[model samples]
Each structure stands twice: as C-alpha cells, then as structure tokens.
Target: MAKRRREHLFIETDGQVYLVRDRGTLRFPRKGEELAFPTRAGGTMDFGDDVVRRLKPVLDHHPEEWYQRDALFDRDDVDGLVKRAIYNTMIRCVSEVVVSKGNRVLMVKATRGFSKGHWNLPGGFMDYGEGPEEGVLREAEEETGVRVVLDGPLNVYVSGFPGKPAYSLGFLFRGHATSEEFRPKADEIERVDWFTVDKALTLTRNPFAKWGLVDFFLQSPEARRALRVRRHGLWDGATRAVRPTVFLDRDGVINRGRKGYVRTPDAFEFLPGAIEGMRILQDAGWRLVLVTNQDMMGWKLVPDRQLHRIHEAMLATLRKEGVRLAEIYYCPHHVLSDCACRKPRPGMMLAAARDLGVDPRQAWMVGDKVLDLEFGRAFGCRVAWVGPKEWRDRFAKEAAEWHPDVVADGLLEAARAIAGRPEGPARGRGAGRGAGRARRRGTARS
Candidate 1:
C-alpha cells in the first residue's frame, strides 16, 4: 500500500497535452551503454515529477512507444503520440533574459546582438534543471555586476526569426537589482549603464527594435501570472524531442592521416571517398564536427597558426567538393596537458555541443584509432570504426575500452552503416565492430 512515485508531469501548450518526464535519472540504456536484451522488464525510469504512475500500457507492447505524442487523442495516431508527449513532458527546457534598470530603464544588453549597437537585456544559455527565475537572476548579476530579484511573470514568445527554419522561441522576465552589487562579468559586457529610454532608442546605431523595451515592458504585467507550463503526454509531447544533431570526429574518418602531425597545409590529405561520404551525410541532415587531438602544439612540433592554415585548406577542399560542416572542433593539447579541450577527455566535443545546442546522445562518432573511438563512445555517441579486423582482435584485449555500433572500410561505407544500409565490400579495409583503421595516415608528412 505504498503510493507510486510520480515521475511524469503534464504540460499543455496551444491546447495540446504534452507529457514530460521530470525524471532523467532512471539510468539504464544511456548513450554508449552496452546494448543487452531485457532479462526482466521491471525497473524504475527517472521521469520528472513526484509520482511514478504505472508504466504506460502501450509501452509494454512497444518500448519505443515513447516517441509519438501530440494530436487530437480521437485521431488514429493519437494513442502512441500521446504516450511520447507525456514521457517528454516529464522534462523541461529553460533559458534566460535580463532586464537591467537604473533610476530609469534605458538600454537592454543583447545576449547575441544582431545589428551593431542594437542592445537588449543580457542573459544566457541555461544549464539543465536550472529554474527560469534562477537563470534570469544569475544572468542579470553576471552581466550587470548587480544582484537582482525576479519580481514578475515569465514572458514567452513562440515566434520565429529570420534565417531560422522554425521560431526564436524564448522566455523573459523583469527584475530589480542594487547598483552596489552590479558589476558585469568581464569580457561579456562592453559597458553597463543607464540611458533615457528615448536616448537609447536614438543613440543605438541599429534601428531594429521590436519596439522600445520600455514600451514593450509597459504593455505586459510584471506581477500578474500567465498560463503555466502546459503539459502533454507520450502522444502529445513528442515534437519537442526531435532526433538529435550529430557531432563527428575528423582525421581518420575524413582523410588519410599525417604521421607525427599534419603540421603544414601541404601535409593535409583526404582519403578515397571521404568527401563524397561527408556530402551524403550532410545532405541527409547530420551536423558534422571534427574532434581531433593535435598534441604537437604542446610538443612544439606545430605552431598554432600552421594548424589553422591546414584547417583552412581542409575546409576549402570540402567546400569545393560540396560538403558543408556545422563546425570543426580540435583539441590542441596532449593527454598530460590537462587542458579541458582535449579528446580521450571529451572537453572539446562537449564544449562544441553546448555551444551548438546539440545533444551528445543523438550524436555519432567515427574514427580509425582506438583512442578516438574510446573518446567518442565515452562522450555519448554511437561509435563506429574503420580499418582492419586484426585491429579489432587486438582491441578485444581492451574490449572494456569502447564499443563500436558498426565498422566499415572508410567514410563512405561508414555513412551507409549509420543510415542502416548494409555496407558493400570495403576495398582497402576489412569490416565488423573490432576492425582495422580505415585509410590510416602516417603521423609524418611525406
């Protein structure tokens, strides 16, 4: 007769029911966690909220039933979507915006300014589980060097902006701060001060203002509460959790390697079918990242500028070949360097994911070397290896190291494997999870 813990909550937006599982902790099949068939199905899933309701009935039949949600429950697709919506609703996404006021409010600092001198309230990306009030307050204090208290309602706009496929969906708040406690976080703020609302409007070189901040704030109530976060279930809340963007590792997967270090631009080289493979994945809508380890800089084997030039050549070649990359993140440190940006460490890729708003779990990593594969797997990506079979056999000794979801010859074949298409014969390399390095490049520039 114990009460079932409630791990899920309901959020309703636009009259649609969305399920959110506040619990993200019922840890089991995390990214990179070994895949295993269920021996017994009974276990707790950390879905948010206080009560753990009976597992959704449909889930017993279809484990992936957590994906469909959002539609009139009366519709044919209603049930599954409802369940996913509910499951997703158990989680939440929150961001921040700051409203700095002096004797009178003037200009608001822009978080990411569009036009030159166009300013708005300063705020930043929120970490997981941080509340909106806490987020805004923290940002206000960090940006203005002032500690403020949230005094009102959360204003949200579900609208789109230019260059965006969807909307610049965001939330905002009004707050009060003391001049004594106000000091901007250095390097983030150019200057923090007060100006007349009219002076701000006129002095700013940029003309685009959704309307002056004062005029906008005047229209909304600071103290009045608005509609709370609406809840949806598995079927209704599904859209919020889109298939994630991927972060890829470069070097081994993109081109033949340079022994010792591909120190100069001339040393940079691409493997066969590499560019085409990248284009295929890009066209299929996957964000490609280049996570590389270049310890030569610490060893003075390569200068930072030389490395940049090499990357420039690499990118130009890709651009000419019609390959578009979301970004290329490199780690210039050695394992002993202890710098947070190196691989086998996950700092660089992790940082890139944070900046690009990508989910590591939804990401994929491919490489030829053991450390690269190990690093990617540890960082939450589904991993793949390219190269030889004996290499995998050698890898078996460290089988506890990393796991590859699939193995193929080179980049082209690997891309096919990710798309769920069986790979053709790997011309220069062998296949399987514990395979050899595909298109291995020497550490020396020949």
Candidate 2:
C-alpha cells in the first residue's frame, strides 16, 4: 500500500516559520526573504506565534520533506480552509445578553462588522478563558456602557447557515441594566437605545439575537406584559400621542383570499382598491394594523420563513404605494386548538391595543368573515363586514346576530363609511343608524 501524504511546515532556528513560493513549489523562505503571510483581507501580516502553535501538531508527526502547509494555505481557498480547520478543531462560543428596563430591551446599532447598521443585542464572541455568563456581561458593558446583572440563562442556541464553514454555540442570558444611561463605544456601536419588545423584534436583524429576544419575551412574564404597554421615549412627550388604529384582516379584506393558504409571495395578490383604501385610512390619521389568522403554520402546511417572505413582499408593495402598517399580529394556531390569539378570541386585538396604545372601543375592524366581525365585537371595536350583498345575505343571520356597524362591498367602501364620507349608496346598512343601534345595544351582548 502507498504511504499517506503528510503535510508539514519548516521551522526556523528562532521558532518562526516562513513560507515562500519559488518555481511553483512551496518551501522555507531564504535567509533575507520577507516574513509575512497573505491575510483574508487582501493584505499581508506577520506569520506570528499563533499560527506557529496551530501548525505545531502537524509538524510533530510529519517529516521535513513532507511539508504541505502551503497546500492548506493556498491563496484561493485560504479563508474557507482556515475557518473549516478552526471550526473542526474547537467549538466557537458566543454570548449575548438581553438587557431589559421596564418593558423595553436595550439594543445597539452596529457601526462595524457583518451586522453593520443593523440592530443587535449587546454581545459578541467569548474570550478564550471567560465563562459564557462573564463574557456576556463584559460584552454588554463594552457595547452599551451598562453593567447588566444577570437574571439567569435564557437559552443556548446552535446556529449556522447551510454551505457555511462557520457555526457558533451561543449562550443567551436574561439581565437588567444598572442604569438607563448609555455611552456606546463609538467605534463599534453607532447608537444605544431601549425599544419595546415588539419594536426590538422588528429592528433586530441578526437571527441569533432575534431568537434570543424571542426566547426572552416568551419566558419572561414581565417582558410579555411590557409588549402591551405604550413605549414612551424622551421625545414622545412633545409629540401627539397614539392615533386610533384600524385593525384589518389579511386574506379576504386586503389581498384576495386563497383556498388553502397564501403560502408564498407569488400566490399573494392584492384586491382592487385595497391599497387605496389603506392609504386613505392612513392619510386620515388612522394607524393601520393587520390582525390575521395564519393557522397553516400550526398545521405545518407552510413554514415560518415562507410566511415571513410572503409578508415581506406584501409590506414592500405597500411601501411602494406610500402605505405602512403600524404592526402585524397573527394567530398561528390550528382552528381546533383553543388558543387565545385566534379570531373571535380578542387576544390579538388586546395585544394590538397594548402594543399600539389604542383603545379598541374607538377603533374599527374591517374584514370579510363572520369570525372577523366576532373578533372585533369581542374587543369592542366597531366592526365592518366587507363582501358582496349575496355573501352578506348568505350569512344574514350572522350579520344581524353580530350587528356590524358598516356592511360594504369592499374595503374602499368600508373606509369611506368609517371616515364619514358618502359611501355612494347604502350597501346593506349604513354606519349612520346601524352603528347607532349596534353601539346602543353594546357589542358585548350576543
């Protein structure tokens, strides 16, 4: 049998190793040759003691003529190979802290590194000898200038991307800041501020940090409660407070309702006048929010990431037309499950009220289904049932039973009626007398 090829490096008298390419062969550098190695950043740096130590094991087993360090450090694949080597040899540990004050989480905007300009938790790679908890505290202080007193470990997450050579074992901790004051390291962090749990979730783009935040919100009752309260910032006192929000149902009300599910972005198509109706409501000083039932997630009919992509496409389209939603809340439970967030349960509405600081009693809920009307009524919202007259007639018993304030053919008519504009002609019952009767009877009854 042929002997296995051995890869090694030549060591000098002073314990430094110099590699050079000569005549298409890799060999030890001549006495007066430059001492440096190509860096992944397209520059050269000293081939220091660290590299020497890493290569020592290979040196111990291989013969002098078997030097193959240059093969491992080939210019074309050096970065990936080095990363793979490190990843295979040892575990890369990272630590992050979720620091909270009241119902707000502290977040930092990265000024450098891969997450530049993105909001992230105050954390980083753990030091060589530091414990995960100690490393997290140190990182928190370094990034936000606040010493965090840890409550406990929130979770341990293993994260990596497919086809990527690097991965990390991340430790997340729940903690509280010593003070509100922050002096962010200017070189690494651009800004340090507190955000409500919902806002923080939207702002943080790093998956690891987002997962940690999600875990913190799920595990901490205090954090969950904070999500409902209005977040008041330093400048909020001088500004007009929260606006009345209009809770919209997603499928039939905004986009064309699908049979099974929307499932993908390509399958999502907006109904005519939907964007115009939303824009009208937004311009009329109403905060637009979406409350939807996405039970396909619970049933495993669609993955969470696919749903996210669909929403992203929808939001991007709305942005193109100058409309924006304040927040989106969806119930991801199966219809058979008794979950609080499902339609007709009032959970999503209550959470929306808390997060957006709007009273549901003064808000409007426009949707096409009986459950949507019931959901709005459950939360004391003025409900508008949007559908053709035939559809309303088919569910006439439910219509009279729920007593929706406005019955419109589509979202545009509903918006007009809600905004106190003439809705052309009465569709089923106008908001004038119907709303008066509905309000007098109280939405809570039947």
The local distance difference test score of each candidate is 0.50, 0.67
TM-score attained by model 2: 0.43
lDDT of 1 by residue, 1-446 (tens): 86655343222323333232325321212222332232322223343434322222211233442323333444443334344434533433334443434323424454343432445454545556787677767766777776677656434533322221222334455555655445655556656666433334333332112122322233334311110111111122111221234455666667667667677888778888888877776665565667777778768788777777888888888889887665566666666865545656555544443334344434677777777666665454567777656765676556435657777778788887775533222223321212112211111100
**Model 2: per-residue lDDT, tens digit, 330-384?**
8777899766577776667656544445444347899999989877765655789
How many collisions between residues are there in candidate 1? 82
Best by TM-score: 2
Off by over 4 Å in 1: 1-243, 399-401, 421-446
- Candidate 2 deviant stretches above 4 angstroms: 1-241, 421-446
On lDDT, the candidate that comes out on top is 2
- Candidate 1: C-alpha lDDT: 0.50
Ten residues in sequence with the least summed lDDT for candidate 2 = 437-446
Q: How close is candidate 1 to the true structure, as a TM-score?
A: 0.42
lDDT score for residue 45 of model 1: 32
